[model samples]
Target: MGARAALRHGAARIERWLEIEREQLVLWLPVMLGAGITAWFVLPDAARWIGFVLGSLALALAAMVLPGGGRAPRALAIAGLALAAGCALIWWRAERVAAPVLARPALAVFAGRVERVEQLPARDMVRVTLSPIGHADLPPRVRVNLARADAPAGLTRGAVIKLRARLMPPPAAAVPGAYDFARVAWFSRLGATGKGFAPVEVVMPGVAPGADLRARLSGHIQSRIAGSGGGIASALATGDQGAITEEDSEAIRRSGLAHLLSVSGLHVTAVTAAAMLLVLRLLALSPTLALRWRLPLAAAGAGALAAVGYTLLTGAEVPTIRSCVAALLVLLALSLGREAITLRLVAAGAFIVLLLWPESLAGPSFQLSFAAVTAIVALHESPRVRGWFRRREEGRGRRLLRGLGSLLLTGIAVELALMPIGLFHFHKAGIYGALANIVAIPLTTFVIMPLEALALALDMVGIGAPVWWLTARALDLLLWLAHITASAPGAVAALPAMPGGAYALIVAGGLWVALWRTRVRWGGLAPFAVGLGWALVTPAPDLLVTGDGRHLAIRTADGAMALLRDRAGDYTRSMLGENSGAEEELALLSEAPDARCSPDLCLVEVRSGARRWRVLATRSGYMVPWAEMIALCKATDVVVSDRRLPPGCIPRWLRLDRDTLAKTGGVAITFADARIRAVRGGGSHPWLTPLTVQPPFAARPEGGGRATR
Candidate 1:
């Protein structure tokens, strides 16, 4: 009798809790849909069809149960249906975007029509996207970088050109859990990338009105502003960021002002709001029109038109399209006298974006943009925040102070929300991003963008020089602020790659806290805290190896990373540094006193607690004798080489040569308690060649083999 009473009490509490939260249920639709999309992306290719079949069955079951089920069962059924629909939608989208990918690297002469041309002023190169002509063997589209001197004259979009170039398949991740460029290229229909070796020959000159206008505007902007500031102005006006210097770009990113360069929600809102206000004021000047006409509706229509025109003029990037959708929604709400900004508006925007571009869910832009908006909306919607705004009126000075304080608080909330995403994708988060944004946001929104627009308008009548000068000055100040903030001590908090489980925990907890209105929302902080702690406590790998086996890094006893090659390229070094969580630059292993080196190979001994391990890596292309290699492999615990090892040349612990690296992509190794643990890279995805099953490499324990897969 006592057990039955306790069970009944627990059930009642759960039922009441569900009843209290029923109104907020609609907010979870996108979350359920996104879950299915994520599962599709992460699942193996062979299992996708099976999973889809199962999802369809589940959807049918849910539909049958939803009509007559209890509250809990009905909620579960709705979630199930959304999840299954998401899976089906993404599966269809992937098939729709499928195109031929380059199978291997080759040097060939080909003719193609230019689709787009991007200038890289910093590198003195111009990258052009082309649609292959008369070559069924090649990919539908390819991108090639040509030196300024090698590129032909009148190289613009729609021009037919011929070139001899070396083309390679889209690049994969450099290290495990790092960025995957191939996945991005796959969705974009770009199958290969290459560099032009010979001068491009122009067969015909073609005209493109959009490309020509953009180029002319960019050239004009650069002529008006003297330095890198002009590049920023051009980016704002035409979305051409190719003119920005690399150093300035880095500074802006590190300082957390990078959003200013992207034409996202902030820019869209500014343009739309400006247009609406202008239209409203002009209509108000005529009292007859104001009294007789639907002024707000007319203003909203004008704003919508402006938003659409701006989005198209700026190349209709994914972020721009998303902002446009949201802006249009806001206009619709205003015209109908409904609340303009709400969580529902954001959810609708996300649903539309996902419906159109499901693959974008995997990108940083979509994640960061949506996360920031959701956080801001959740914050402002809180009862306490609303109460504070309803306080008695105050003096002008006090009102100004309150407004600034609100801006700062909003900035802090957005930073906290974006931290997990930043760490997951970049392995680092800006420490002072909230503080930097407080100043940067207003300056860009009020001073720089408005002045830029005004100057462009004046340029049509040939009196824009003065306003253009002011725009340049303001941009210079913005750049200066970015540099100062980025140079500050401890501006970035770097972490090693976070585990997927921890990342998921943080995201789930954040959504729970943002979506719920009851005190139960506090429970989400528990998982959020645990996820952060887990990421901070996890140990980084002891050794790193690139996919090509040409570069290697090991953490030394002094707690510094040492590299096998000192002359590695900047990109390779940066990637190694990020993955290893090294705060300082990597030093050459050859400079270490404990390392021994020959012309072809270098050997280093690393100690972890009481266990000592030996690592031998190739230093040059020169091949060592087979007998010497066999002897060396026996001596070292691990052997890493760009070339394939000879037969019977296995090491006591592990061997990572060309054949293994080709399959694994990259390898991260850890040593502890007389055991060697290795984590290999590459995944079963369409963009990547499927990895074949292989026999486990055996590591000898006490002269007997222990297998590792």
Candidate 2:
């Protein structure tokens, strides 16, 4: 009886906590979605749509059957249901875009409309995105590299053209655990990418699908404005970064103003707010309209319309749509004269963006933009901040000072809040971002954005040259400011790679603390500490293997990563050099201080602690005797070859070749106390299958049988 009473008391405590959280529970939907996706990627099974559906159904059943005797049980069940919902949504999305993949490079000849065109700066060629002919004939969409001499001087969108191109599968991850190009390509609905050899045919001509408004707007701006001014104008107006040069992009990044380059929340919010205020002033000037009708409502509606126009004029990506949605919600609240709720508005935006593109959960733009905005909203809308701002508005002079202070505060909050995420994805963070914003944001907000908008407006009437010139002058100043600020000490700092699950956990903990309005929210710091600890203590991999198994690299005692080969394929060399993320050089990894090497083969001994293991690396020529191969395998612990070994080779020896490397994408070997273990570079992604291995063979069972003892 005493134990039962104790249990009841504990249950009551949990119930009260749940009640405290109920008001803000909806905002946790993204957290649930992120958890589900993380689980999907980490799970060691080949998940199909049928499995996801069944799993969702099972979860739904469990939720329905769960006892309602306690609030704790109900809350747990709801969490399960949310996870199931996310799984079902992602599975459905993946199935809709799945396409047949090409296994080898072949000359594919197909005639289709060109949807997008980008000029290759280094080569005198144009890269074109061709529409899919059929779901089965080729990939859903193909990017063809066309030599400029064989085609028209300029190829705009929607030009029907026939070309011969060497087509291959969309590339997989460039390095083990690096960016997954294949997954991104799948989500983007691109099936193949290649270079066109001979392209000399044009069947028809029309405007591009997305270029109807952007093309006309960009062309007018370029014609009216020249040089970097026109380039910046075109980028801001039409969401084209290709017009900006590499040096300008680098300058912007170093200055901590790369956010300005993208059409995101800041640009959208500023443009819509400015348009609304202008409309409101005009409405206020009409005495009869202002007194007789709801001028505020009219202005709000006009603002929403402006936002829609801006969305269409610029690139309507996931982050841009999310900002538009948030702004519209705020306008709706104001028009109705209802109190605005920040959490609900953010929740709605997140729901809509995730519903449209679930894969965006993995992108830096969505995470950083949302995190910053959410943190700012939480800070500015808090009671203490509201009271302070109200006090600051006591006089006209104070109001100006308050506005400047608020801007500075906002920049600080956003930069600090987004620091961990930037570090996780880019392995770098800007220390002087807040200071940079002080000089950058005002120029952009007051002078640059307004002037660019006016320039576009004037271009519609063919009188844009004067305004374009002013805009160019402002842009030059902005560039000069960027160059100065970015050159400051500690402007940007580099970070090492994080451990498994560190990024997800850190983000989730931040959300937990930000979404709740109680002092108990401090508990979120525990998970954050755990993630940071993982990042600090986790040792990087010792050995790097390529997807093709032809090249290998390892970290040496002298602290520079060393490669096994002096020369390798471009992809292999790049992946190894980049993925190591440490001080690296092109020096070869040799077993002995002085090693013997021939054109076809090289022998090296790798020393780890008290243990030593031999490694045999060779180029093509499987025609070598099976006995010689067996002896080489017996003498070495690892065998990396350019081509596949003969069927008679021993399976017990650890080996990687052209035939078996794709299974794991790559592997990282770790040696501790002379015992070696391997960790996979590629995780569970739909584009590349989940990797599984114990050692000697990672090939299909039928192929492994040939080398079995």
Candidate 3:
């Protein structure tokens, strides 16, 4: 009797909770779609087709039974259908964008017409996208980088150029769970990336009106405002970031002001609002038209047009497109006298974007942009918040103070919402981002952008120099703030790679908290806290080996990382450092007191609690004698080399050589409980090379190797 009563009570509680959330069900549609898309991306290639077929069948079954079922069944059916549609959408998108990827690295002479040219002023190089004229094997588009000196003079869009170049396929992730450059390049239709050799020549030059305009505008802006400030202004005006110095870019990113350059919601909203206000004022001057016409509707239409124009002018990136769509929806809402900002509006924008570009779901820009907007909207829409910020008759000083307080609170909420995302993608989060944004957002939106527009308008009469000077000074101040904030102690909190499960937990919990208005929403805090705790307690990998077998990072007993080579490039060093969660510079392994080195290889011993790992890694391309190799392998627990090893040269635990690394891509190793575990990266995704078949490893015979008890 007691058990029956408890069961009945639990069932009743769950039923009540579901009833409360019933009204918010519609808001979960985009979340379900994103889940399905994420599923497609993470599943193995072979499993994707099977999963899609199963989902389709489920959808069909649900549709057939939906009409005859009760409310619960109908809701389940709708959710199932949405998930299936998401899977189908992503699969279709991937197939539609499929292009031939370069299979191998090569050096050859090729002629092609330049489709686009991007200047890299900081690096003194130019990157041009080309349409190969005669290379049937090459994909439709390829991007090549050339030194300014080697590039032909007057290289522009539509100019045909010939050059000898070293070309390679798009690169894969540096390690498992890192950024996948190949996936990005695949979606972008770039078949190969290369650097040009000398003897570059231009075959012909053709005119491109739009490219010329953009180039002229960027050049004009840069010439007027000197230094990195001009680069920023050009980015804002022309969507060309090539002129921005790398140092400034880093500082801006660290300060959380990088969004200013992205030309998203803030910029789009500003442009639309300005256009609407201008039209309203102009129409008001003509009293006859103002009285006869639907002036607000006309203004809305004008604002929509301006939003579209600005989006196109800014290259229509994913975030820009999302902002444009949302801005248009807002205008539509105003014209209909309906609420302009709501969760439904955000959902609609996300739904449209996902339908058009499913691949973007995997990119950080899409995730961060939508997440930020959703969080802000949810925060401001809370009943308590609305009542607090409600307009009341007050003194100017009090009103101004309230406004500043609102801004600060909004900034803090956004930073908190974006923290997990930033850490997942970048391995670091800006601690002072909220404080930095409080000043930077208003400065960029009101002061710098207005000055820039006025200067551009005055340039028609060549009297823009003074206005341009003011713009530059304002930009200089913004830059100064970014530098100061970024350079502050503890400004950046760097972490090791976050596990996918933890990230998923945080995102799901965050959505639950944001989407629900009921007291039940507080339950979400449980999962969010759990995920943060999981991330905090996770251990960094003890060993990191690059996919190419050219670099290795080993964490010693002191919790300091040492590199195999001191001459590793900055990118390689940084990646390794981030992955290992190293806070200081990495020392060369050969220089470490415990490491023994020779011309051919370096040997190091690492201790993990009661167990010790012996590692031998090749340092050069020189081939060691087969007998010596076997002897060396016998003494080590793991062996790493850039060259292929013979079948008999197996280590006690693992062997990673050219052949294996070609298959695994990269490997991260961890040690615990007297055992070693290795995580390798390689998938059958379209962007990755087709993996070669190899026989599985057999355990060593008894007495063939020493045992570590």
Candidate 4:
């Protein structure tokens, strides 16, 4: 009785404290997000520890400053602070330990079994995780980022291989003002990466001949599951991304339904829930089974089996495991007759995940997965959206409509929930992502799975081409859909990446406001505002050039425009578009001339006067003489020449070489001082060195600035 009273008293006191300082808490959110962003930069390979420590320190300080006179409030504050601090410290320590280990380059002959394999399309690379054979000194698992060299020949599960190659830390963020790749990789629990190897030298331990039988059996099961349904069943049964095409991916991204592609938490839950329902239905049908306890046990068993199968189909990604574990917890709690699900289960799931794969916290899958979970929980509890889902399960049409509505709602919710991190890391979003998901989700889930399963089964039977053809058709259809949707108006948007400080605060604030139901939620808004301000007020580009610089980019209040050059091919055309050729990039430059991709040439409109013919100078071509083409020059007021003018224009051009001519032309441009530079070169400039020649156009000492123009 005394212990219960003390606990109640403590809770009441903490609630009062939160109620009193809710506003201040909101102001702290930006600080936390800023910390998270900074942590990414400082320990890009894995810096969760730093954020953890800092957050803990802040909480401790707040606890110390609390004016409460009661023992319960003071103790509660200290506990909360300690928890935050511990999380931060753990993040920092994990990163420090992993960075050097991953970065060391050496030829390691570690024997290990294949844990998982993933294919990356952007880099055309394949990554595999290996469980070290007997090396106790190293982490239990290490990730090998290798090219798919000869993998098609034969590489199967449980095959122990001796890999030989130079292993180094994962690649860091290569592009400037981009995501912190180092941190991202760290969160992925990747110890090291390697490339460049020959399969001939690598030894693969032989497996028993019967091992092939098991592979065949698994293949058969996977095939049947994949072929069972068109889109939905395929997604549910096997996490075969091959069933999804580029177009469907785009549509899903645009529709904000991309989560439906991989067998993430939702899919896992769906599978589990379906299994549980089936088990319960079976129990109800059997007159011999009257005990409620038996039903829970049966459901638990079914859920575990389904979870394991789903994981195998999806390659058992970290996110899948997290979801599985969390679902298992909920089921267990239910079996124990718990009246309600507590956040403890979710917390436990997080703890187990971090303990198992400490690095996963940095990966998108981890963040996105957890973000979806947190948002769902928060939204479900929200005063407005609360009970909305539970109240609408009547009628067939309503169920279907509600299902669709729920998916749409989920997409929007997840996207909005993850907005700060998404913007900070990617600086853009597929505008039409939400719509794409609605169609792709159903199709991939029901149709593609069945096709893929059929193909795999047929392959086992030595006649898989028919199934393969069907799968191919499914892929083709998806690709076509994504292509069409991606081409649609406002299909994508690009913005500046969020600054570190603002990003951290946003993240912190979001956690406080979104997760905690206390008055501290109000404090989250401040950081959110700060983050938005930074994103919305992005810095303008350093230079803007109209196509090929023959026509200057017109600067406007909202943005600047570089009228594209008509004389350039696709490569140069894209470069002139500020290194972006995606839908959003093209849409932003809508006023520019249409860009045509062709076999030999790509033409874009140069904003220069139509009468003034402009050609980007190549090694073989020089500026055309204006006098010779008086007809063409009639409407042209001025000729912006990039080629060297005759020696008469320089007065000292008696012995001119390519260098002198190039220097003279480069300096005579008003936009040089601006960020834009005009490059007119071709082939290799082997002779060029770190040397410069003063051009005649150099400004005199008395002038305000250089008079290159």
Candidate 5:
């Protein structure tokens, strides 16, 4: 009887839990549905948020009037519905504001407070944001991409400056056929972006020297924290990533430890947990305050302090804000004795982010942050899986092992989750990424970050002695680790361009697997398989030809390519990834000889040796005889010149040098395959004439060729 009762009790508990989860899911159905629909029919040239708002309001009314017996459900429904509509509406407004700014030939003049600066050393680009100046139509901030290669000029927040610039639209999605730009301008609510900047006079109005104290304090803290043994400290404490070089960034990214740099849920959760432990320890020392109420009070205080400090340090970005909200929600739930950390929290936080700053949904930060948190929470809640690491204890050995395991798990999970995204956005993946992350992540979390924080504090107090020593040591250690990791063989792998839908499917499948504990482990497999297949099978042009044969690029089956330049235009070749740089498409083209062409319209008739070949340059041009060059042309392959042709003969296509063509058009006869050959008697080097060509001998079964630049 006792054993039977225990089994029954266990079954009862599971049923109850499922019931609760079902209720929660029902409550959020409207929200998820609304967000899904809004994201689906998004338009480029038209405002899309209007439909989203109408749909959300309609859903809310339906929920309110539904035949259910609960005030709580109705309230939840109202909140969820509002959040959904709000997110879409905000995105719409942001895009509307940014559209005019991004239009070509559009110029805007405004004055605003400087908010922040982001410098990308690898891309040699810098972005600056400014608070709005005058018009409501103008964005709350503007981003400028530097057009020149000048050494970094420091700009701090609160500095009022004016400028004249042309706005360029944010990049559109290039997902083959999808709405380009991912509707980012809509999601982020950004006003405008520009390619250049000419700073107007800094209107220096006499103000208190310490008016902008937070920036000063953060900067001081960064200096001190950087004194420690790792790059992690400086990153954790302050958002200044300029210290992380390109090589270091690449190593960290490859190793999947790049998440350590972003001050998102992980960073915030760590700080919160640490603060709570400290506070609980303090209360335990008092004995009298070890009560449950006291615990709640301590948690609240510690969590709030940590949230504020971290947010301030990180510049209150969208990812940081979302993390802060999650932390706050978790703390509140603990205080209120609520055991639910379901999709509700995730949805709520997402809704808030989109409602407040909808554009964040389009950014990698927002996606990565939520992805990590959602995966972790779902994994933690799974009843079937045992704890991967034991609860924290005082044993130093145990602590170290646990830390290492956590690092490994986090790296693997995040990288796996983001692999498709990285490939789609970057066209490359780091083979050495996991190894790099293993080495770098723990070092940052434990030793380097703490020292950097300490250094920054010391610097604030004007005590430069010990902090400088720490900072130097930390920098050397980080640089060494990065250099070694980056040098590993197969450290980087290049891939062909990935289609946008492939990324979408992969991301969706990954999320489903990570965020829900269904028997859907195989759910992610389909997208992964599809993405890989698409990448391998997509058709790309095999050859790129120029009219003069001076410039060329070829593509291979694996989507790698190479270029060959007749003259020293290294920049052009580099752009094509023909030289030492990594351009997958151009790299493949460099390996074929039979596919290559010589100067003029010459076809290598036969190979005499590695260095010599029998070549023929067809005097290819267009002709107009009998008003058509068909009978003989159709019977066999014929090349003609427009000038030599009587009356009007129309060949399939005409080929001519830049100077020879009578009409200039956008299409450049780049690379030609065997299907095209030069016309006879067009001219030795035809200029100022139309040229005709016939397909190369497709049936000749020519051997493969390689071209080099």
Candidate 6:
């Protein structure tokens, strides 16, 4: 009787909790859907279908039995349905977008029409997106890179071009959960990527109609303006970052201006506000209409149209689409003279975006964008927060101080909201973001954005020079400010990589705090506190082995990652976002006490507890003493070699070489308790483009070499 009573008591508490959560089903439904989308990234490829099936079955069963009695039952039913729908949605979208796999890397000559051209100023490479080649099995688009040395004179959209190209499957993630280039490529409808050699022949000169027109116009805008300033102007005007310099990009990131560079909320808000005002003023200028109907409804229509225009002009990327949807929702509320941009609208907009692109749950852009806006909206609506800042002082001096204080507080709130996300995704925070925002936000929101919009309009009449000049100047000032701020000591702080589930817990806590309708919402704090502890406690990886490649990196006792000078390291470094100058600080091949090397081979010793492990990394083409090779292979803990080792030379040695890489691609490994565990770049999903391969005589998987890069 005691045990049964205790069980009933526990169940009662759960029912009570559900009853409370059911009141906020509006928020809960979307949050659950978002979780389903996230499960796509977390669950392995094979297990994804299981989630979809189980989730769907749960919802189906709940729907059959009307959940009308207890609030807990209703809430549970709703949650189950949402989760099932979310999982099903992932597969629905994935299957719809799935296309052919390249299977392996290959070089071939091809012909296709140029759909788009991207000039990468930093890499000095021209990227060309082409229509599907001769093969019907290939994807609809193929992207090729032209080395600066071999770049053609130019490329025009709609122009049919032919060139010798090396084609291969899109890259897998550099590390598990790092980033999935393969999935990105699949969604982009691009099956292959490779370098092109020789001149691009224009069989037919033309450009695709419709949306490419906007892209073409952007290019023309760049052509009309001159120099790097033109690049920045074009980028700001039409969501293109290809021309932006890498150095400037870094500075922009450090100064908190990077988000502004992306085509999203800031740009959309400025455009919508301007459009609404312009329409209202134009309508007011007409005496009859002004007297008859001065309601915001008509202006709301104009704002929606303007937002749509901007979305189209910017290629309708996921971020742009999300912003536009939210903007339109706000405009819809304005038509009814209701409060715009309320939590209800946010929740509705989020649900709509999830339906449109369930895969976005895995992208940092989606997470950061939504998280920032959600925090801003919640804070702005908080009665207590608003009450504290309500002051009536009217002097110019007092007004200036109040305005600055408001902006500063806003900056602090946004940064606080984004801290967990920033650390988890990019692994860095701008120490000077607040200071930088004080100087930069107003300039960007008020001056730069306005001028860019005006410039686009002026360009149609060939009189945009004045606006373009002003816009360029504003951008130049922004760039200057970014450089100054980034150069300051401690302007950027590096964060250690978060442990598994740390980010998810943070997300859950944030959602609970933001979504709960009542005071019990404070309960979310427990999960948040636990998550923070985990993030801070998770240890940085001590060993990094190239997944299928020969390159190896090790975190030294002092906390710096050292790469062997002879190995390919730069490519992996880019993905990892090593703190500034990590490469410069990396120990050379000859620096380790127990490691020594010649051109063909190097042997190093590693320790875990009281035991030592030997590792051999070698390139085989060059001559090497065989007797020493035998010694190195004796019970070697790991071997990544290009050469064929003597058969059973050392029975205990673990070999990871060209053949292993050919079959499995690359993997990273960690060492512990008398064993080595390897992690592939990431699991290959059904959605990935299949790749085919032809290995050469000396096929070495490059950790950061040509293969991985």
lDDT of each: 0.82, 0.69, 0.82, 0.51, 0.52, 0.70
Question: Tens digit of lDDT per residue, candidate 3, span 394-488?
Answer: 99999999888888889988998988888888887888998999999999989998899999999999999999999999999999999999899
For candidate 1, what is the total of clashing residue pairs? 0
Superposed on all Cα atoms, the candidates' RMSDs to the truth, in angstroms, are 7.3, 7.1, 7.5, 13.7, 13.1, 4.7
Q: Where in model 5 is the C-alpha error above 4 Å?
A: 1-91, 94-99, 102-200, 206-234, 277-296, 339-344, 387-410, 518-532, 535-559, 563-709
Of the two candidates 2 and 3, the one with more favorable TM-score, higher being better, is 3
Off by over 4 Å in 4: 1-154, 157-169, 179-254, 291-293, 339-348, 355-358, 387-408, 438-484, 516-523, 540-709
Candidate 1 residue lDDT tens string, 541-562 = 7888988899988888787888
State model 6's lDDT: 0.70
Q: Per-residue lDDT of 134-167 in model 5, one digit per residue for the tens?
A: 6454556567665325312335455666655555
Colliding pairs, model 1: none
Model 2 local distance difference test score: 0.69
For TM-score, the strongest prediction is 1
Off by over 4 Å in 3: 1-23, 52-71, 208-211, 673-682, 689-709
lDDT of 4 by residue, 251-302 (tens): 5555455566657777777678767877888887876785545876787789
User: How should the candidates be ordered by TM-score, best one leading?
Assistant: 1, 3, 6, 2, 5, 4
Prediction 5 TM-score vs. true: 0.65
Pitting candidate 2 against candidate 6, the one with the higher lDDT is 6
TM-score of each: 0.93, 0.84, 0.92, 0.60, 0.65, 0.88
- Deviation in Å, model 1, residue 702 alpha carbon: 60
Error of 2 at 6 (Å): 2.8
Expressed as tens digits, the lDDT of each residue in 478-498 for candidate 6 is 889999988888877665556
Full candidate order by lDDT, most accurate first: 3, 1, 6, 2, 5, 4
State the lDDT of candidate 2 residue by residue for 96-147, as single tens digits.
Answer: 7776555556655567778877643324456788885533556657777766
> Any idea what lDDT model 3 has?
0.82
Q: Per-prediction count of colliding residue pairs?
A: 0, 1, 0, 63, 62, 18
